[model samples]
Target: MALFNKMLASIGIGTAKVDTRLDSDRYLPGQTVQGKVEIRGGSVEQKIEEIYLTLHTTYIKEQDDKKYTQTAALEKLRLNDPFTIAPGELRTMPFSLVLPNDTPLTYGRTKVWISTGLEIKNAVDPSDEDFIQILPGPIVHAALLALTDLGFKLRQAECEAVSYKLNHHRPFIQEFEFIPVTGPYHGKLDELEISFLSVSEERAEILLEVDRKAKGLAGLFAEAMEMDETMVRAFITKQDIPQMREKLNQIISRYI
Candidate 1:
């Protein structure tokens, strides 16, 4: 029976299993995530080579005129050194990691999760996945509120693949689309797209693409040539939150 059990464990029939439990499922960018990795042993003794946690999300990528969803690792954390587990044993290890500042918010079709994995030789490694919700940080949240106060309503949000030159930190970026519904820009602009290129406690670097409403011959011609759209970068700090409405108005008006 011992030999049979060993054989079964080797083939993952009774191999060790892993599960990760987070202190909370909701978090903000740049916050610390605390969790525990639980291991349940199988019918026989097995050696675990390593345990690791990876933060992952999906982004849309275009290839050959077709779009595909791709999984990406935003960050990784390795825990507990190699150890041995006896039959029917249980072990729990605590861990902590700083979430990446560029982690995308849980919006639209974008989903974020933490994957826990175990490395074992000659066996199918056991793994676990825990989905998590990422909320906008203080600075980013303030900007969003400011935009709403200025009469722009959020239309959509999504993550899309980006070039290395655009963002050296990550392979994708999250974009938020807004349209004027009631305020000063109601009749002047077509739409607005915003991307938080980089964000932190101190400041947030934003990229704004302003689309102007086409008018007569000159405006129609500019639209056809793609000149009706303008792209610009802006930096907002904690102090700027109070005046974000005015500041955004000035910046966007220059383009319109």
Candidate 2:
């Protein structure tokens, strides 16, 4: 029976299992996430080659008319060296992984998670996935709040393909689309889209697309022809905001 159990475990019948427990439900970019992976042995002893943890998120890549959802690996961490697990034994390993400064925020349909994998010799590897929410970092949070203060109403946001000029690791980026209901930009603009290509504690790089409100007969023709939008790119340090809010008023004036 013992021999049968070992063979069965090797074939993934009753193998060791992994469970990851995070210290918190929410994490921020550039923050070190502390978690523990608990491995519980199954019916028999097994030799685990190594343990790995990875951060994963989905991206959409379109080819022709079909779209494919591809998983992007933000980071990987090797948990430990090879070890043996006796039947019914439980081992807990603690880990601290620093999130990427540009980790995509969990907004709308976007999802982010950490996966734990146990590599074993000649056996179907066991794995576990734990989903978590990613909140904007300090600089990003402040910028979003400032936009709210400026009367820009944030609407839908999504992760999509970004141009190379944005300068990002992954092939896509998250854009927050806004429309001014009040404040300085109210009537002059039709839409505004902001993409945070690079975000850190000190500074953040932004890509802004401004759509001008059409007017007059020529403007009406331009609107009909879809020629009313302009794109702007800029970067701001943490020290720039609030005052930058006032400066933003001036900068947007030029865009209009």
TM-score for every candidate vs. truth?
0.95, 0.91
- Clash tally, candidates in order: 0, 0
State the lDDT of candidate 2 residue by residue for 1-256, as single tens digits: 9988878987999999999999987998888989899999988889999999999888777789898887889999998989999989999999999999888889877899999999988678999999889998777877777777788988877787767775668888888888898988898898888889888788988888888899899878877887877777788788876576665565567878
Tens-place lDDT digits, model 1, residues 49-81: 999999999999999999999999989998978
Residue 14's lDDT within candidate 2 is 90
The local lDDT score (0 to 100) that residue 255 gets in candidate 1 is 85
Screening candidate 2 with a backbone cut-off below 3 angstroms (N, C-alpha, C), the clashing residue pairs are none
Specify the highest-TM-score model's number. 1
Worst ten-residue run, lDDT, model 1?
162-171
